[model samples]
Target chain A: MSETPASSVPRRVRDASEAEILDRLLPRYAAARGAEVGPGDDAAVMIQLGDRYVVTTDMMIHGPDFRWAWHTPFELGWKAAVTNLADVYAMGARPTGLVIALAATADTELTALEELADGLTAACARLAPGCAVVGGDLSVSDTFTIAITAFGDLEDRAPVLRSGARVGDVIALAGDAGRAAHGLDLLFAEGVDAAGVPNADATAALRAREPELVAAQLTPNPPIPAGIDAALAGATSMMDVSDGLALDASRIARASSVALDLDTAAFAAEPNLERALRGGEDHALLATFPATSTLPEPFRAIGVVRAGAGVLRDGAPLTGKLGWDPYTAWDGQLG
Target chain B: MSETPASSVPRRVRDASEAEILDRLLPRYAAARGAEVGPGDDAAVMIQLGDRYVVTTDMMIHGPDFRWAWHTPFELGWKAAVTNLADVYAMGARPTGLVIALAATADTELTALEELADGLTAACARLAPGCAVVGGDLSVSDTFTIAITAFGDLEDRAPVLRSGARVGDVIALAGDAGRAAHGLDLLFAEGVDAAGVPNADATAALRAREPELVAAQLTPNPPIPAGIDAALAGATSMMDVSDGLALDASRIARASSVALDLDTAAFAAEPNLERALRGGEDHALLATFPATSTLPEPFRAIGVVRAGAGVLRDGAPLTGKLGWDPYTAWDGQLG
Candidate 1:
């Protein structure tokens, strides 16, 4: 995945003991701000802020979840962290700690794993200051898997939930709508072969041509701070727009028993309107606020909440597929 | 691994959508006791008991960490939950919540996953009362993996660390030491063919003959409650004896800058003294208490701390392999 030639990778995971690999990887992570006992213990201890805390987990696997040839280990780590952090932020909480469980093949390059640790550290420092990896586990497996569980401090604020949306509220989204999905389309169309095989040379060329789109797909920097802002701004309801705008909005609508009526004109700046509606993995924050509340920074109004069910585009029922489904969408293809 | 007939499992995971599978599985988990916002939200919010919490993570992969041919889905889930819970218990905290990330092949049976959820719930209810699965993610992968992150409430008590052991302290152990490892050996010797293929009939026969050993290996019930008892009784140091007595004792010795002088005479009651000293995965609690302190129920004195470095057996340095290492020990054989 990395451009660092395979020849330069000095050792594989199998060549070293688990302790040796951990000695190299663990130092790259910064200690959590609230940590009392960090990485060396059987469990990490952290000081809590309020009487409540938020927790979420997600997993990224090789083959079905990703194509190893199309992503650097650093990007994989960053994306994994971003996705989980987005869930915690959706609850109107500030990210504080992360614990990773990684399973990889014996032949995996040790340097790649180190780079992954670096990316995790960098993302925590940049997106959520004071948050860091608190603990982790390593194991050997045929299919590479990275599972991260992120914790957040509520800061004494009540968590915002998808079921809190009220009728006649303003619908807003923070961060790009379809950029990551559009990047996926570009990668498959321009960088992959007819048989769905990834060509590294073609991918590099595409990266050069569309750095923003490619970066969006690879290392997404979700609007983490906007979650706390929306909560403080009196958000009625909130969620992470993970499985496409239409699908995720529908979830909110179903949960709140309301309808989200969207205006495509608000998305006129996007390169593809359809992708904005149907594409997935953008990791944006979708929130609804009272009509009297002022919209927070980075959030732009795209629609309004009505007394109905499901999502509507320009006042019509959304047609075609809603979003990605791992079970039905994965076609046994891998890079 | 279950005795249920294969034909009884009527549906595969691929036959249903991810939402459909979630709809069936999510309800099986009980809400955490402190949950303000449980599953169905982007993240779960739990009210903290004190100003601090302990967190730990562990992963079980299909091949190196577990054998599909040797364990039922229920056992796998129980083992996964127990393993993580033991880590929290070792820190002298009460487990409050768990978030699981499960990845399995599309061809996996839907019933198997449901049984896994049931196992997780049963373990939480029985071992760590009030603790439950608060959130989880499901994905498709070629190799089945279960990654669980457990959170524990400190109850405003200080966490017990491995580095607190002092010279002249009493080294104590609660629960069986070598039974799980012995079960693994029995399975490999009697229930598997020379080519490393599992024979279900042989496995069933062996399970019936040695139920306790097999149960120890499959669904271990670690001394979870004793962790709090040890802490309340003024334990100097504690950890889960997961990687053999000699090896884990050596870790405490190195961390505390003292030697653990174990008496094999104390292990004479065990069926296999050698396995008790060198085997792994029993999930026993190992703690050190002051010489003047009374030992807690279920905890028995096994040795004493001395002014030296590393583990000593009857005044001699321990010899032979310490314990299991996934990287160096796996022989590329799967049943």
Candidate 2:
């Protein structure tokens, strides 16, 4: 018989199960506060606050949004945690804890799960110190999927909303972009071999090594701490990089009754212009600062907020419309 | 052609779409707290605790646990929320918020999703007033699955745990038992269409009609308020019903160094004695009271805690197991 369609092939490796992933991931979160009972219990027990709590969740589906050929379980796990944690950080909060729900096929191997958990552990260790996984449920399904819910503590800071961006503010980006997009391009491009490569292998060593682009796609270092820093620095508005810059900038522009104009020349000077502009999954922090505020390090000046609507590049309209929107048709492939 | 095997049939409804289901469900949760940016937003937002928070999550998969024909979208949503909420409440906390992650075939209809959301909202309204549907992610998948994470506030009460039960205590249950098991029996025998016809019709006619068994199966009512009450009443140990009474009771016994002597005669008075002993999903509150403490109203005194090693039924050794265990060869069904 002819080979099955690539789309119909199960992308997940069978030997690494979700439980094995958790076993590798849970220990790193031992430092979280009020974690009387952590992972492995029926549920995790944490010290509860009398005040309100911030909560959010997200899911990563294979095939439709991600592919096993491009990403390892480790990278997928890390990216999933970052996506959820960044939302909490964008609200001007410190993540306290998280709960994960995973669904995989019965044949998934334990090692693959371990690698995914390692990615989750690495990400959580960076974003939420002392936070431990409390409880989760696992089941066998036709494809692999992960659902995560992150809880955060506002710590008395006012929440930062997309609508808070004001006119005449300076729009700045903190953290790198385009690396992930480049990485995705390299992974999906024909005649490339990612499986044979070693971890220490430099991006330049590979024929398609695009360091800046690949970094952005593979391990999105969400400026979570920087979001808090911006909030403390009196940022008026803030959000994370999920959709492309052009699309997300438009959202801020629409919310604040202002036109967001990006300096394209500045982006061009960067390593990869296309990746910096349209590249998504950067998890970078974009905030609006008033004219009076002094910009901090790593916070690059990208654009300005003016009295208008929609995003502009170098005073000209951006054509392709780069960014993430659920209703629209995405590339339907993961980096 | 001959009729297709049940396994070959699509799990989701062919006519209703996913988007349609979301449209209907979003409005029902319009009143939930922290729904500032509900379903349509990139990520939902809510107020965070000025301090700490408790979080937990669970996942339900088709085939391994549930069949589509046996449960409606509403029941699945409601039960998913209930299971997660019970974990939070078991820690002697009151639920404050929820996040859902869903995966279904693209062919699934919107009406089905709306029903699921309806079930979720209905359960939340009764269990956690003003709790928000903070955020979630959705995707099309080969199988139908759902994951839910719930958060809660302790409100100054100390969390009651399983480790606190001691000798010379009274074992009590607040809420009915075996109803879920009996409902499962009916469901397996007649399938969802014919199962609980009386209760289903009564629910349509009068909302107050107590479909104890059927309701137990569809949507378990975890005693959130009662958990707080138990903590306030100086309960030594407490937990929610998930595994059968015998197994869960044995857990308490092992943890508390007490032998539990359950009165079989008391359970025999109930219509479904076997179901009560082995059935799960009761979501009922089981707690141990000190000898000097007065039992609360509506709570049935089912057994006594004595210094010993394991669980007993009417002072006799249990010849057969009384609760469900994951390691065992279960028939692959939900309680």
Model 1 per-residue lDDT tens digits across residues A1-335 = 33344464348877778888889999999988988888878899989988899999999998777777789999998899999899989999999999999997877988899999998998888788889999999988888899999999999999999998999899999999999999998988887866768777788999999999999998999786799999999998999988899999999999999999988999999888999987888899999999889999999999999989999988998888988887788876663
For residue B247, give model 1's deviation from the true position in Å: 1.2
TM-score of chain A by itself in each prediction: 0.96, 0.81
State what share of the real interface contacts each candidate retains.
0.95, 0.55
**Which candidate leads in TM-score?**
1
DockQ score for candidate 1:
0.88
- Candidate 2 per-residue C-alpha lDDT over A216-324 given as tens digits, one digit per residue, 9 for 90 to 100: 6767776677777887887888778777777777877777778888887668756778778887777778888887888765677798887777888887777775665
Q: By DockQ thresholds, what CAPRI class is model 1?
A: high
Candidate 1 local lDDT, B96-174, one digit each (tens): 9999999978788888999999999989988998899999899989889999999999999899999999999999998
Against the true structure, candidate 1 has what lDDT? 0.89
lDDT by candidate, in order shown: 0.89, 0.69
For every candidate, what is the interface RMSD in angstroms?
0.7, 4.0
Q: Rounded to one decimal, what is candidate 1's iRMSD?
A: 0.7
